[model samples]
Target: MDATFPRARKNQLGYKTSEVEEFLQRARRAYDGRPLPDDAPLDSERIRLTAFGMQKGGYSTAHVDAAMERLEDAFAFQERQIASRLHGDEAWLSEARTTAQVVANRLARPEGQRFDRVSRLALGYNVREVDRFADRLTRYFRDGWPIAIDDVRGVVFSAQRGGYRESQVDLVLDAVVDVMLAVR
Candidate 1:
């Protein structure tokens, strides 16, 4: 079914209307099993990492982002399913395992050491705090530390100089979670 989303009122700061609509149209087509254009990009990674422009009186950003995250999950699940069918279960699991190992290896490093720090001119998540959380995540991956997906989704960090890059951290988290879910 095609989902209808609520739009922001005039003067509200939200995501760009046209971009959301265009992307949602293609998302609907994919979800609804209709053929999409040849140029359409539906990869979960692409959707997860995409940035949207903000506009006044457009779609609410929080709402759009939530919806897109759901869409990305759906696509990722479907990707796993397709891969299983195409490559057989063992092969798919093998690939997912490799990806998970890579994530685990990276997370094993000290949080601040894992990703490049953002320029001082541009603010990002506080290095010390993110590294602390990264410690938790590393434990989770390395020693089966008791943390849930909610923890990953709910992470917040303070601003600091030369902090962990926001986009990089987010992308890595997304990738790790995607692999975990796919393999599970």
Candidate 2:
């Protein structure tokens, strides 16, 4: 399946290959309705926070990160489903509204006040660029303007002075997308 992945030669160390395989096997089993290990944890936050040790020829970091993002999305989707079933539509949407408001509050702040600033030596999405998109998102969620998941997914920000934190913006966007998907 990973024909392009570099392999370790004789006596060379690869990404704990066995560990990766075991983890993937466990993940598949957990996702396919099978019981997980007693100590296994696959919740969204855990998935988001988890990191693997790297070896000389470990699995590609980019590949692992992409896979983790997909897994986070899946876990978030499942949580939305559960909330809908447990709390009913109105309560679930109410929770989503709260999430929207938190993002909106952040966006409403003054440019430099909105989020933790990136270091001058560091790079991140431009503050103005992100705020502009945030304005549009707020309009969609609060003012009832039409928006699609593609709109959120397609947003690109420029690079500039002390841009908003990428992880913060991304988490908010993910939550917004989750709400939109739940409504549909």
Candidate 3:
């Protein structure tokens, strides 16, 4: 039995050892990133469970299997919560940015200091600024930020009122490039 298990560790292709290890690593990262308020007892419990599961011939396959299953469930739930919170924050930031852009546009003078509303929004929320807005537009392929395309569309549609034309979006692109370089 010892030989079979020991040798099996070297050839874990059939078993889900790597998957379990990755799951454990993710669990550790999640737990460490934002620890719970009463996490000490849970930490001790995990340590004890882990030690119990890892002892030499102490735990059966069933015990380890159950432990791993529970750990994965916990990890998945926490991961979902974290992802939801991040998406919510991004959404709020995007809205704030669009409003900020409208305000900034009013505050802007056609011939005074130039401003790039989109870049300011992206960079303000930890998104990387790029040399060109066109080059970086692909980053918003996901359905997360509302202000990115909003600003682009707004600039085009409101150009007449803003005393510019849809063609003036090129200037917005230039402003993006300017902010990217200046902010760095």
Which candidate's TM-score is highest?
1
Ranking by TM-score: 1, 2, 3
Residue-level lDDT of model 3, residues 1-184, one tens digit each, is: 2321221233232334444454455456556775445434333124223422233333245544555545534544454455458876465445445644543453343432233334322322111222233323333322223334224422323221222232244445433322222211
TM-score of each: 0.81, 0.61, 0.23
Name the best candidate (by lDDT).
1
lDDT of 1: 0.76
List residue ranges in candidate 2 displaced over 4 A: 1-24, 44-77, 150-154
Q: What lDDT does each candidate get? A: 0.76, 0.70, 0.37
The deviation in Å at residue 182 for candidate 2 is: 3.6
- Model 1 stretches astray by more than 4 angstroms: 1-3, 32-38, 118-122, 146-150
**Per-residue CA lDDT of candidate 1, range 1-184, in tens?**
4435566788788788788888887777776678456736567777777777888877777788788777777887888888888988898788777877887787777546888888888888888887787788778767887876646765788888777888888877886677666765
What global local distance difference test value does model 2 have?
Answer: 0.70
Alpha carbon lDDT of residue 133, candidate 2? 82
| Residue 85 lDDT in candidate 1 | 88
Model 3: clashing residue pairs?
Answer: none
- Ordered from best to worst lDDT, the candidate numbers read 1, 2, 3
TM accuracy, model 2: 0.61
